[model samples]
Target: MNIVNEIISSLKKIQESNEITVPSIKNKLTFSQIHCIAAIEYIEDANITKLSQELGMTTGAITKMCKKLLNEGYVWKYQKEGNNKEMYYNLTELGLGVCKIHKKVHEKSYNKKKAIISQYNNEEKVTILRFLNDMNSIIEDTFSEVVENYTGSDD
Candidate 1:
């Protein structure tokens, strides 16, 4: 197959496998919501501005998601001392519970894949890893070039 076809086939396989493994996690959480949760987990404590920057979303979009999460009782909001405008958000007990569940689901999926791949001989595994690494490097370079061009950057 040609390179473009090979790339498309690889992406389709990865996406299909992800869907099969993860199932309906996306039904309970939008992509942006998951990203926001991950950012919050990373920062532990963050305000709306920080979340927007970290998630590459607008403040308005983050605010909307935060409102939904708050209304769902997955997150709690509080104002910092002497700064009502500077509100902070963190996962509530329920949110943490959901996070733990998601973590386990991810861990199980990863472990299953790892076990299967571990059955391969050492040299074969190394070859597979190297190919995957090269694919990742190519994708990253292409993405970087696209982003730079879109942003009118010179590099």
Candidate 2:
């Protein structure tokens, strides 16, 4: 197959693998909800501002998600001793349980893919890695140019 077709096929396989592994954990939560939870798990005691930046969401959206999580008993928010206006959030027992399940699913998917890739010979592995790296670099460069043009400045 040609390079473009090969790239498309690889991306499709990646999407399929992610779907297979993600549905179990995602069934109990919306994609955005699960992403918020996972982001919180990564940075414990994060406030709304931090969550908004990390999740690429607006503070208002994060606040709504936080409220739902709190109401569902999956997370709790508390004010710091010296900062009553700034509240921090952490996952409760239920949230941690979900995080653990998500972690397990990710690990399983990684291991399964790794096992299959390991069967490839050293030369084949090197070629695959090189192609992936080159593709990533090309994508990054193209997007950077586009963003610079849109912003009217390059940093």
Candidate 3:
């Protein structure tokens, strides 16, 4: 139980440490912007609708975010050879640089977690995995409930 509490505190710190500064981006990238950049990098032919679906945001919301990303040189939007009406977005060189930095940070963090898990035996690892999955499910349910109940005001 004590170890579990300690782990929870440490994980909170780890989560906070995810913010990394990219010298070129100039503007501080929010969590959403980082994810949006990563998604564009991962998906070829990423259009507004596709990104909106992937990010669970409306196309209008995505368009607004992408506008900022484009103005900041983090992304580029263009149409395909025959597609004038639809536009696709991709990471620019600077965006790719930031993504690489972000990826390395994530990989290092996960690698540390994996190393810690390796200390446990197979049975313990299985138990830990199951516990994590169950906790994640509970968190998802709780988050949905919170969103549903939110009034967005103190009064």
Candidate that would win on lDDT: 3
Clash pairs, candidate 1, are: none
Please give, for residues 72-111, the per-residue lDDT of candidate 2 as tens digits: 8778889878887998888887788778877787799899
Candidate 1: segments with Cα more than 4 A from true spot: 1-8, 15-32, 38-43, 48-73, 92-94, 153-155
lDDT-wise, the better of 2 and 3 is 3
Q: How high is each candidate's TM-score?
A: 0.65, 0.64, 0.75
Residue-pair clashes, model 1: 0
Error of 3 at 36 (Å): 1.9
User: In model 1, what is the error at residue 118, expressed in angstroms?
Assistant: 1.1
Tens-digit lDDT track for model 1 on 1-155?
99989978987787455322234333367556756765666685688899998888789999999999888777888887888678889887766766676678779989999999989999999998998898889888998899889889654
- Please provide, for model 3 over 1-155, each residue's C-alpha lDDT reduced to its tens digit, 9 standing for 90 to 100: 69989888976776576455677667788777888899999988998888999999889989998999999999998988876899899899998998898898789989998899989999998998898798679878988888777855444
Question: Over 4 Å off in model 2, which ranges?
Answer: 1-6, 12-36, 48-74, 153-155
TM-score (C-alpha) between model 2 and the true structure = 0.64
Task: Please list all clashing residue pairs in model 3, or write none if there are none.
Answer: none
| Model 2 backbone overlap count | 0
Point out the worst 10-residue segment of candidate 2 by lDDT.
18-27
CA lDDT of every candidate: 0.77, 0.81, 0.86
